[model samples]
Target: MIQTGQSIPEVVVQQITPKGIEKTDTVSLFGTGKTVLFAVPGAFTPTCSEQHLPGFVQHFDEFRRQGYDVACMAVNDPFVMQAWMKSAGVPDGMRMVADGNAELARALGLELDASAYGMGIRSKRFAMLIQDGAVKQLFVEAPGEFRVSTAEHMLEAIAG
Candidate 1:
């Protein structure tokens, strides 16, 4: 697991936009300014859809007010990410990034294998407060835990 004060890995991810598909690197994603990046194990999974992503979606405005560019990533294809965003009612503030081959997850050293649950090579559920492409704070969950490292928690961390 990558820690705070470490530079984020230079990993390229596929951005699925209504316009089309495009490639973007991690620096490109977080370079504009401070960014709040959260990763989930899988797209459309119960916890991700019902809680994790929705927490971010609901608190996106607050995150933006605190000067953070918000993004969500998963180890799934671009098309699936796009569809899941729609189904989950993702708001405009949150950008959905696709780590199609788990490259980004691997680069972050946050990759997880969930073969028993039928998910192969997925990202762990974690959130990081990154500034200028470097990690400022990291909140990673233990397997199946979702209380901390949430959008609300990250917001509080930013506030304090």
Candidate 2:
């Protein structure tokens, strides 16, 4: 997994919008500003939709208040991401990114295989605090665990 002070991999992501899908590079998505890049195992999955993503959604205002642009990435297709965000009631501040091929996950060294659970190659559940396009802090969950690395924790990290 990526660590603090390391430069994250520059990868392309597809953004699903009401009109259509748009391709965007990581540098463009992250830009030269503070960002919170959170990755989930899958879109619309039990924990991801109910807990992980919603945690960020619920605290999105606080994140922005602390001066961070937020983005969520998953290994699903752009269409799936779009529907998931709508169904999950994602807030306005969070941008959903589709990494359909796992390229970004592999580049970040956070890819996880969940074939036993019927999920293909996917990103591990994690979140990072990035500043000026460089990683400043990383919060990665143990497999099948959800607690730390949540939006609340990241909010505290931002505060401290």
Candidate 3:
């Protein structure tokens, strides 16, 4: 798994744009600023929809005030992610990123095999603070758990 001070992999991540789905390198998204990034197992899942994502959206302005750009990533396509954002009423402060094919998830060593559950490979729940292209802090949840990798937890870590 990627650790503190390690550079994130330069993989392609897609997001919805006015014209259509636009693709960009992962580094470009989390590489340059004090970035707050959280990953969920999948979009629209029970915990993710009801809790994980909402927490971030609620704290989005606070994260920005703390000098961070917040984003949520999933192992879903950009279209699905966009739809999820609308469905969940996610605010503009939080951007949705698609790691389709698990590219970034695999590079971070956070891929969870869920074939038995018919979900294939998905990202493990995680939140991290990235600064100037390097990881400053990372909180990866235990299997099927969601205790640490939360917006509040990340904010607390950042405050300290």
Query: lDDT of model 1 at residue 44?
Result: 89
lDDT of 1 by residue, 1-160 (tens): 7888888889889976666668989888886599999999989899999899999999999898888988999999999999998998887757899999999899889999988888888999999999998899998899989977799999989998
User: What is candidate 3's lDDT per residue for 31-63, written digit by digit as tens?
Assistant: 788898899999989999999999998888899
Q: How do all models score by TM-score?
A: 0.96, 0.95, 0.96
How far residue 141's Cα lies from its native spot in candidate 1, in Å, is 0.2
Q: Summarize candidate 2's per-residue lDDT along 10-81 as a digit string, tens digits.
A: 998898665668998988877589999899999989999888898998888988888898889999999899
Which residue pairs in model 2 clash with each other?
none
Model 1 spans with C-alpha error above 4 angstroms: none
- Angstrom error of the Cα, residue 154, model 2: value is 0.5
Which scores better on TM-score, 1 or 2? Answer: 1
Among all windows of 10 consecutive residues in model 3, the one with the lowest summed lDDT is: 15-24
Of the two candidates 2 and 3, the one with more favorable TM-score, higher being better, is 3
Error of 2 at 29 (Å): 1.1
